[model samples]
Target chain A: MHSRTSFSVLIFILLIWEILVNLLHIPKFILPAPSLIIYTCFSQAPLLLENTLVTAVEILLGLMISLAISIPLAIVMFSFPSVDAAITPFLVISQAIPIFALAPLLVVWFGYGLLSKIIMATIVIFFPLTVSLHSGFKQVDPDYEVLFDLLDASFWKKMRFLYWPAALPSFFAGLKMAVAVATIGAVLGEWVGAQKGLGYLMIQMNARLRTDMLFAALVWLSAMGMGMWLLVGKLEKHFLFWLNDTKN
Target chain B: MLRVCDISKIYSDLAVFTNISFMVEKGSFAAFLGPSGCGKSTLFRVIAGIESSDSGHIEWEGLKLLNLKENTAMMLQKDLLLPWFDILDNVLIPIKTLKRDTKTGESEAKRLLSRFGLSGFEHYLPYQISGGMRQRAALVRTLLFDREIFLLDEPLSALDALTRQSLQKEILRIQLEFDKTVLMITHDIMEALMLADKIFLLSHLPMRIIKEIDLSNLPKPRYHLDFELAEMAENIFFTLKGELINA
Candidate 1:
């Protein structure tokens, strides 16, 4: 019921946008009409779909690699404060450096392949995942630890039962932010230098003033970002049912 | 029997407790009745080997219990129920840690919860339940470990009067039924009188055991009691009051 209202509001805005673009007689180069963009999206669907798939693969792989690295990094930092103290400042500095600024350097060093783009997305993903998960591990109620200790719990048992369950909510929080940034990172890396991606296509169309295709590519990127975000939200709801007030 | 001898703990420059010596007999219910902030919880921690005393020796059945946590199951004052886990998962924590058969362990947890009047609450998280229910779940978790001794650190302090009285009776019954030795810490004199087979009354810091009373002769359902038990409760209250006055 709530979603239907939002969907109607979106359609209403799009109809107004289409009417205004047609009535004002805006040129196709500066701002294409919604109809022109939709036509371009469908007519050139095969080419656009290929680029979208490439970008999606990069973002998804980058996110998977980030998870592989950051969860363990967060665990190590939580387990040993001295390691956290040694490494945390550098991690903060890495996030402080803008990804756009790093994109050219990454392309140059990693040689403009899928590897460079994946690295860029990973760079964007690693910080939030580590920081949020580290906070989760550190912020547990002291009472919980005392209970585990009283049980004579082994280290692995404590990690599996206590730390894992306790940190899941925060890990999901980090995952939401990380997945959102992943698309941007993939596009930015492609913008620097890539042979085939939506970012590469956008650069090509903008240079030649094929503004309809450029807008179509932007639309696809936005759709991809929203799709990933919605996926994470769904996962949160399914796994964190215990937090809800309802019986189910 | 568990013996704690010459236990003294000094925090920083100040002494929290000194020369705290006591013994809890096997299968006996012992209560440490003390004033608030008299380091009763700290003493229990020391005995459980969660913390170390500056000078002390704790032994169970003649063997030194340097790491007593291996054998002692503690129910903290706060229920300390893991917020993420359901009551069944929370109660099965000890079984999971000990690497027991989780299938049978889960069945045992269900039985205990049903016995504790928490039959429909197996899937509920700690926050979904009332304070009394959470306390009952915590007790079930502690009991599942099947430890030789139980350390109850003011377990009923958070409940209302009626709930406290009910739980007091229930715990006394559990002690007798399971033949368990329980060392309970509380500031309620009447509670000590009703449930404890023996009570050790400690004064405020630097805390020491000032009085010990035997309540084994008292009958069951001692909450509202005969004249002799009532007089004994009054005397214990005055003893604690005199310590406050001196302090």
Candidate 2:
């Protein structure tokens, strides 16, 4: 019900586009009307679905791999200041290099398969997750550490109990931020070289001057991004449920 | 019994405190009364073995406290209750960390909550409760560890005046019931007078004990407007005022 207003606004814009295309006699190849895009979306649904599945799988795999790697890396950095000092500069340099520029190199290294795209997405997501979580570990209330010390809490116990629970909000923030960019990274990989994916489909259709099909591919990509974001939001609500509403 | 002997802490090149010495007999209540930023909390940390002092010794029952971290529990100015945890889980932190039996810990936590008038609030998160309740939960957490010495660094200063009064009585009761040594730090002279059997008045930075007052003769269930206690409070106030001026 809340989304109805946004839907209405979208419909209003579509009506304007449909009216302008017919009134101005705009060529369909250059700028298809919303009606043509919607028609193409339905007519080529099966082909779009297949490409969307491939892209969706790549994004999910990338996010999973990023989580698996970044959490442990963050914990290691948190545990060892010398290691953090050594690794932080490399992390910053790697992050500075644009993911788009690295995509072709990744494809060359990992082959023109789903692995390359997964690595691309993982690279885009890794920094935010690791840095946010590491800072969270470092920024715990000093009083809490003092309390833990008074209890003679072991390092492992401190990590499992105090550090992990304290870092949940930051972890969720990183996850949400990662979701926003994960799809773009996956598409960039496909753009460089991929046998299947919405990015590859978009490129093929654009080369053929099939603008309607290109828009359809874009629609599916955006839908996948939206799906990921909603899923993360749900997980945040369920797992970090103790966070106060005022904080949000 | 706990003995803190000539402990000094220097951060970088600056000394925070020097030649700080005190003792709390077993089951005794002591207060380290000092101005803000006088390193009272740092002294507590040193005693708790969280931070090491530049030079000095702290011993409990003839054994050095440096290796006896498990025998001390600290209650800081802020309750510092884990906001994510409910009251029960908050109090069970030590037990879980020590790898004790959860079933026994849960029952003990339940008994403590009810004993402290915190019954029926076991499931409430820290943010869901009042400031006083949060402090009570922190006390429950500190008490659950079965430690012999407690380092309370201005534990009740953040509460409202009335809550402060009641919690002071609760603290007195806790000391008696647990038969534990308590070294509390506070700037409020009345609070120090009301709760402490002995008071160590500390001067400003590079803190040293300006005067040590013995109040063992003060009447129990100390009234708010007692003349004898008020006289001592006034005397300490002027002495502290003099110290402030000299510093």
lDDT, each prediction:
0.88, 0.88
- What is candidate 1's CAPRI-style docking category based on DockQ? medium
Which candidate achieves the best DockQ against the true structure?
2
Candidate 1, what DockQ? 0.59
- What's each prediction's TM-score? 0.90, 0.96
lDDT of 1 by residue, B113-231 (tens): 99999999999888889999999999899899888889999999999998998788778877988888999998787888788889998998999989888877776667555687789
Q: Could you tell me how far off, in angstroms, the CA of residue A220 lies in candidate 1 after the best superposition?
A: 1.4
Model 2 DockQ reads: 0.72
Separately for all candidates shown, the number of backbone clashes (residues 3 or more apart, or on different chains) is 0, 0
Each candidate's DockQ = 0.59, 0.72
- lDDT score, candidate 1, position A56: 91
**What tens-digit string does per-residue lDDT give for candidate 2 at A15-132?**
9999999999999889898999999999999999999999999988988999999999999999999999999999999899988789989999999899999999999989999998
Question: What is the interface root-mean-square deviation of candidate 2?
Answer: 1.5
